[model samples]
Target: MKIENIRPGDIEAESFRIIGELLGDRKLDPRYEHIIKRCIHTSADFDYADSLYFSEGAEERIARGIREGAVIVTDTKMAQAGINKTRIGKYGGQVLCYIGDSDVAEEAKSRGLTRSYVSMEKASRLGRPVIFAIGNAPTALMAICDLAEAGQLDPVAVIGVPVGFVNVEASKERLIRSGIPCIVARGRKGGSNIAACIVNAIQYSL
Candidate 1:
């Protein structure tokens, strides 16, 4: 098979064009089109078109929060690294991943908890608007839900898409019912890349 010669700058645009063609006649909510397309682009999986779920007004809330300089916290460094820090910075926003922080590690170890869980606890104390983009750990989603239930946290929005077999769907379900603005990938299909792409798609749409 011969590779098609294409200009570097046109590759992404071309890819989206193809995705649109393949999805012909499938109407997408205008608010979520870019996010769904970005998810498919990142993973080359069309399943995202059907699996992604958005709570009412989630996009608007997230956009407003970002404009207000909400801190974006991710479960994994890979997710954090994939986010467009420069673009978010233009709005005075920043991306952070605390899973690898030394203090988080120590606390998790002492408490016999996953570092991802500890990270959410740490984030809850920020005292400012926050957006959680959790893609690799269901426990992180659980921790956030727990915090919310206890009246200790009120995040601007949550992107819950952790991929796994154990407790993944349940955690996402909990987040969905928590009454927080969120974007979730139903079932057991998601990743750090998907999480970051979703965040980037939101930023791009703004």
Candidate 2:
């Protein structure tokens, strides 16, 4: 049966199975696996989309793309995080820089991205036509979308990928309330491994 067709508990089991197939013994530890199992099983509702996480610097690459010309809205952490991949010239898409802190913003500036923003206000001024909000900073992203709707910012598509167990629903619900298309993986499947896997799929699909 399809993943969506199953109950929440069943879906968690299926997630374990799929993750097991893809990741194998790396995540097979009983305790961590049990945590994942419990989280997915108890959370009654969720939306499944390709998700991604970054322990190293995948968020940096994503941020760089935004800075250059990509119309994407991300959390402070993802925006500030730097990209550190061996394959540099592979992602030649778009760049629209939106960041949270001074350090990441400074780094983006060094990369010739002077149009970086530290707040949702900056994101508004940038006027990106499409905004993809990734990771768990929902309230901030919602504020950005609200501004867009209020004519204070350029209107665009708002998507949220809130990784982690914290405020996952509230963040996603904000996106939903804004009448934007938000894609999120179910439950606590918002860690580095799942996040990386989700991004990998997006890369391949794109």
Candidate 3:
């Protein structure tokens, strides 16, 4: 086995120093900066800092939900797997994915709805405060917003960052106006990894 004397903690510390240097005179509210840095770090894309949209106090709301043991639901299995589940577990959060599940498939087929919408419907029924970490399927993001507005699903926070030209921009825009605490990536640049990165940043902070 290859064993190193240095602990894993050193890497993040060093990376932070480098990131800080590269960031230069540009500044964000310190409280929200780490989330941007983490996203960029995860994808090596500097555009995330400008792309991320946050509601007032969204970070605090999300952290509180995490500490309160919110059920974290993802629209895709890739997103579910990409989250730092170990870190989420530290705060009593559990990740959930209903996509590709037999029940979800059956319901989607029955209703002629996308599995993403079915997953959001299921998330609503968890009865616990939900932190939706969606990275694919703009349909899920749009559905969650509609459900929230219609007095159906009441998610504590939504991380909506699906990538593509189709409905990607529109869904995120809807989340901004959905009246829920949201951290969204606007425009056509997002994916499962970026979505998971945002979740991990909040978990790491608290």
The residue-by-residue lDDT of candidate 3 on 1-206, one tens digit each, is 99547678798777777787887887866888989998888887878878888899888988999888888999988888888888678778899999988898999999999999988898898889898999988999988988888898888889988999888898889889877889988899989998888888888888
- In model 1, which runs have C-alpha deviations exceeding 4 angstroms? none
Which structure is stronger by lDDT: 2 or 3?
Answer: 3
CA lDDT of every candidate: 0.94, 0.44, 0.87
Positional deviation of residue 129's Cα in model 2 after best superposition, in angstroms: 2.8
RMSD to true structure for each model, in Å:
0.9, 12.8, 3.2
Superposition TM-score, candidate 1 onto the true structure: 0.98
Top candidate (TM-score): 1
- Tell me how far the alpha carbon of residue 142 in candidate 3 is from the true structure, in angstroms, after superposition: 1.1
Q: What TM-score would each prediction reach against the true structure?
A: 0.98, 0.46, 0.92
Off by over 4 Å in 2: 1-69, 77-118, 153-156, 163-167, 186-200
